[model samples]
Target: MSRFFVNVYSIWAAFWFVFTFLLIFPFQFIFLQKEAWKPMAHRCNRVWAHLFFPLVGMPIRVRYEAGKPDPNQAYVFAANHFSYLDVASMMLIVDTYFAFLGKDVLKKAPLFGYMFSKLHIQVDRNDPKSRSKSLQRSYRALESGRSMVIYPEGGIRTSNPPQMHPSFKDGAFRMAIREQVPLIPISLLNNYQLLPDKKNMRLYPGSVKAVIHKPIETKGMTEADVENLRQQVFDIIQKTLDEYTANPKAHQNEFKRLTVI
Candidate 1:
């Protein structure tokens, strides 16, 4: 818990992360062009996250409140983004043939950036042309039977740390509505504590707890229902966060909920 310990851990984490990247990314990059999407789409992400968690000393546990996601089905997952570690945490949940609808800027990040540019849907939000291309790419990914993960908040909207952003953007919901994919809202309860968005970085060894909520159906949803569906997903994720924050111990165990929204 000391600053010195956290500093020491960060140094170790950086070395291990780069080491793991060197070990895994080359094959992932090669397969992105050479193999089918399902075979290579999430291979590096899953492997990198599995390696990153231990080096950072965080045991990220994914609890299925509804049940384990169906590998055979595709989904549009919208999760709360509150920390630098959120995306890494997300990689743990997306176990099936999956790709992320992530920011275009992420593709510039060193070795992993090449994977982002090639395998995932990268959106430059400021450019209308880029957004259109990204949307089309997302639709194609979904239609091809590969699941996709999207942060509906549009890249860390809440500047004041861990609270849910005031409102959700509709690109992710709109994609689900138009493409008719099931929407799953993910609750990343403690990712912020692991790595906050602050000037002074404090990386530490901690548990990354998360909830895999039931997939909210968007089968009959239209453009008009985007707000309603977005609100519903936001509420589901926010409420779980509130519960976990109020009594961390009460919600530690893996949960199972029979209800589907």
Candidate 2:
């Protein structure tokens, strides 16, 4: 709770994070070498997260408002961005193979950067050319029947906790419509509280909770529907966050415990 303890715990968590990644780096490197083996490299990421989170005392739990998703189907997943921990927490959310559409800055992170650049799609949000190229890559991935995880807020630009950034970008919605895939909305209920986007980057150990809403069907939808669909997903996640902020305990027992160990 104190600043000193928060710093210490964060440092400890960071240590385990880097250590676990090092253990799996060789396998990931090999898996990333061939296009056919990229999915295996993503799974290695999940393994690393499972090892790091528990060691740092963060257990992940999920509750589905709708039924669980079918692993065989491809989907576009959109969730609010609030903390660095959200990246790792995603490995716990979707069980099947998927790639993340994250900021290009992640491509610069030490060992993880190389793996991410090869295994996932990265975009420079500020550059029109880069965004267009990333969207093309995402389209190709969807066409190949692979799912994608995108933070519709673009990045963690929110200064407020529990409250999401007012605008949700249309990229996720457009991709879902164009690909004729289901768009899944997720609410990361408590990540910002556990580990916020701040300069100091302090972290606390606790149960990370997420709510996966029912998939919004995009079949037969046109480009004209992108705005409505984006707003619809935003409202779903924002409403869930409001409810959790009002009564966090009401949703705790509602979630089925997901075993990470």
Candidate 3:
């Protein structure tokens, strides 16, 4: 696609994103009014994502290598962070209700930020106190049977596409170990190409592909195993990402055989 069309499509996507959020804001606010209604607020978020993506010409396709997750179980979902699209794309991947451990900067994004602050756990990674508080909240969420979506790369620090940042944080692994929940590794195959992390924020119309690997059971694991567990999840996601990146045709073909949600 030409630069002109990319810019036009990006703008079109952005407009629908904001417009849909605004359209859903009233329902979100009402659903968020009580503690019990928060899950309904998350459902509102999923509805918003379902509306915005197709309206912007992007369809989400996910393949579960080990089969879909059990609805009754809670998991710690860790995925590579490459683009802004990862956040919304998550809503499409996991059907069960969960909270996101996102950067505190999301709390500054106009009207959306306010809702995010109330619904998700935001952390200032630079602040020790804030990080501690966020982790505590994450622990409580898991204790209450809700899952969490955490980017182990710690916020898109990678300069190269498909290649992850060198280090993975121990928070996600540690929390899963402590909570005795299964940890699921997810690979977002092509979000960076669809919407590159750039100043211009250009978006292309294409299918958003993701692979949900089998969950790694953490029951009976101790804190000493954090490093090994983190490395395991990282390797699983990185290998899938490298495979798909090397064979774009294979990636495209795989999605065609699977249903697009």
The residue-by-residue lDDT of candidate 3 on 1-261, one tens digit each, is: 799999888899889999999999999989887889999999999989888887887888887888889877889999999999999888878889899999999989987898899899999999999999999999999999999999999999999979999899999999999999999999999999998999878889888899988999999999999999999999999999999988866745445322233
List TM-score per model, in order: 0.93, 0.97, 0.96
Please give the clash total of every predicted structure, in order. 0, 0, 0
Model 1, 59-105: lDDT tens per residue?
76778877888999988888999887887767776678777888889
Q: What is the lDDT of residue 22 in candidate 1?
A: 87
RMSD of 2: 1.1
lDDT of 2 at 237: 94
Of the candidates numbered 1 and 2, which has the greater TM-score value? 2
Report the error of model 2 at residue 175, Å.
Answer: 0.1
lDDT of 2 by residue, 1-261 (tens): 788888899899989988999999999999999999988898898888788878887888899877788889999999999998898889978877898998989889898899999999999999999999999999999999899999999898788878899998899999999999999999999999898887777888788899999999999999999999999999999999999899999866779766553
